[model samples]
Target chain A: MQQLPREESLRLLGSVPLGRLVFTQNALPAIRPVNHVLDGENIVVRLNDGATLTSIAPPAGEAGLVVAYEADAIDPHTRLGWSVIVTGYARLVADPSQVARYEELLRPWVAQTMNGVLRIQPDLVTGFRLVAQPAVAVCAAGGEGR
Target chain B: MQQLPREESLRLLGSVPLGRLVFTQNALPAIRPVNHVLDGENIVVRLNDGATLTSIAPPAGEAGLVVAYEADAIDPHTRLGWSVIVTGYARLVADPSQVARYEELLRPWVAQTMNGVLRIQPDLVTGFRLVAQPAVAVCAAGGEGR
Candidate 1:
């Protein structure tokens, strides 16, 4: 596995339209696959008003909601892929103009009208690329390839 | 989208051997794609001794590691699939017998020898199926399907 630089990580993140958003509900973790659009440095996602993520999001003034956003593209056959993880503070985008802009740019996947626009301001970014090791490298490292 | 029952969720989980495990490192969220095996009710994963997960895991006797395991299969063309999330407590399997048992049963994806065996005991399981809404159903509901 090779660690990716921050810029490369963010680029890879933007390459995928679908990803998983992870947060805690009642002190237990919960995750949902969400469609997202990258806007500069922020990750923009739409959540329904009644969705758990929207309900659990911290108020604008409060310490923003800390969540994990992850996206990846891995070939099931070759098992080669790159994954990116972003840990950020999420808050509702209350500005009407911004909300309208996002609505036009990002089409929600579900049937419900996504009235809640949440932006994740990432503080930590990390990623890794999974590459198959050659037999020579494995032997050089004193191990047998599986 | 339809909410899946517990049995269906577990069955879907068992069908896939790959998933993402989410945890916290330095108060920030982290995620890694890992290969796992369903052992009765526990989700077993192998991590190298120097891996981030093994280093951050809570030691024995303390409250087990709180983590989230998520897996899914979605078609890129249709954007339809099932996603499963399991909120669980992870603990290292110190029993040599169990470790050996798992090593033989589960093949690690990487070349490294997975020295750490972590078992996640799930406390909550939830999943959802994303099915494309038929045009008729959308029209009946007074909306247009995307």
Candidate 2:
């Protein structure tokens, strides 16, 4: 698997129509399927009253989070796919101007009604792809087919 | 989605056997599908010389991970199955006694060699399920295609 740069990584993330947004709070991990669009430099997400927004926006010290957005190839037997992840300090943009910008730039393709918060200002991001290797390669541990 | 307890959540994770093991190091995110099992309250994972292990065992301060495991029905439109998740901190256990116990408790069910570092500690676990609902409710999203 080849490593992709920041720009290409953002591109790949935006290209996928849907991804599972993973985050943690109080050491408890949570994930949800979301439709997000990549907006310059940051992986901006529009959150309703779902898991993404609430689980991450707890009190300040309690807000440590790791958000992973991934989309994989359609095949399972042959696990061929790529993913980009951003792990950083995610903060709710209560600031009016930033909120307005996110609303204007990134739009959720579909799903959810109320726009409660936006995760902006990601600290780091990277991309990876599992080559189109034989199904055996995908299993890494050999395809015991768990 | 049905809310389940600690034991059931671990069971669902063990049952799937394949999923994205997400973690971060130096704020960079990484994911890898590991053939894993549930040994009581711990997430029993067999590691190779891979990025996943490297990321999971990053300097203690920089360590955080979210294991995204799922056992969902193939057809979203059917809404006939459920998916569960377990999120928590992971540690590298070179403890021989614990490793041997896991070896007996979980036989590698996949086609992979069962030799490597094993992660067996968890801080949190949570799960969700989609009960068997009929067509009308399934299509409520209008996107869950049968």
Docking class of 1: acceptable
lDDT of 2 by residue, A1-146 (tens): 66788777777777764556666544444565554556666566677664546655642345544565554433344444666766565556666787777665544333236464446445666676656544445344454434
Per-residue alpha-carbon lDDT of candidate 2 for residues B54-112, written as tens digits (9 for 90 to 100): 54564234453444443322233343344555556666655688777766555443334
Native A-B interface contacts kept, per candidate: 0.33, 0.09
The DockQ-derived docking category for candidate 2 is: incorrect
In candidate 1 the C-alpha lDDT for residue A127 amounts to 87
> Candidate 2's error at A24, in angstroms?
5.3
Candidate 2's displacement at residue A63, Å, is 13
lDDT of each: 0.78, 0.55
Which clashing pairs does model 1 show?
none
lDDT of 1 at A140: 33
